[model samples]
Target: MRYTVVLSYAFTPAWLSLSRDERNAMEEQYIQPVFAKYADQVAARFFDAEAFHAQHTDFALLETEDLQAYYHLVEELRDTPLISRQYLTFTDIRIGVEGGYRTFEVLTRARE
Candidate 1:
């Protein structure tokens, strides 16, 4: 089964206070590596929503078949400066499976 997780998060003042170079460095040193480590197990796409939204500044749309790897990815991210040092604040997360109704339908047929 494949799962799609939408993680909505905001960029804190601390993050904006950093210079472009510093921000790039932070992503390179902390954020990018974690995603790279989970590259095979998860597919991630980040969206910039600051201009369009009021509550959250950005969101990551992640798709994965392996929940364990996804969980580990989150754990690693929590340890990074992005979250630990308050660079990014998570606002909400929505998890679901595409075509989820089909799974139930299949189960219903099997039981019939």
Candidate 2:
């Protein structure tokens, strides 16, 4: 089974204070390493939504087969400056399983 998680976050004033180069450097130094650690278990893609939305500035789409690894990935990120120093504030998280209904139906139904 595969799980998809959408994590929405907004940049705080602290983040805006940084130059573009600083932001990119921070992402590379802090964020990228966490993702790289879980590369085999989880896949992540980031999207910018500040232009389209009022609340969230960005959202990350993460697909994973291993929930434990995903959980660890988030834990590691939480310790980074992005979250610890209030550079980014997490607003919401939505998790779903791809084609999960079929899997549940098979597991819950009576067998002949």
Candidate 3:
């Protein structure tokens, strides 16, 4: 089985004040390794932008064979400073298996 995981980040007011290189460096150093550790069970890709634009943001797509591993990866990421301070969103998860249909479920919290 294979799954596609998309992780996106929207900057907060404080995050917006940082330089692009600063933010990129932080993500590269902190986040990339975490994703890389599970590279065998998962394959990951990243997207980054120079500034905050509705159409532009940082994101990652992970292809994984283990759903449990994927969930664990998400949990691990949630604690990272890069994610803790940013508005995070994940989507485009699809399961691929022969002779079966693909499905996924996501639970999102409503902002206060």
The CA lDDT of each predicted structure is 0.95, 0.96, 0.66
87 in model 2: Cα distance from truth in Å? 0.3
Clashing pairs in 3: none
Off by over 4 Å in 1: none
For model 2, the superposed segments whose C-alpha errors exceed 4 Å read 109-112
Residue 100 C-alpha lDDT in model 2 = 100
Give TM-scores for every candidate, taking all chains together and pairing residue i with residue i. 0.95, 0.94, 0.63
Query: Model 2 reaches what TM-score against the true structure?
Result: 0.94
Least lDDT summed over 10 consecutive residues: which range in candidate 1? 98-107
lDDT of 2: 0.96
Q: TM-score for candidate 1, please give it.
A: 0.95
Candidate 2 differs from the real structure by a C-alpha RMSD in angstroms, to one decimal, of: 1.3
Per-residue alpha-carbon lDDT of model 2 for 1-112, expressed as tens digits?
Answer: 9999999999998999999999999999999999999999999999999999999999999999999999999999999989999999989999999999998888788562
* Position 27, candidate 2: lDDT: 95
Q: Answer with 1 or 2, whichever has the higher TM-score.
A: 1
lDDT, residue 32, model 2: 97
Model 3, runs deviating above 4 Å: 48-56, 87-99, 102-112
Model 2 clash pairs?
none
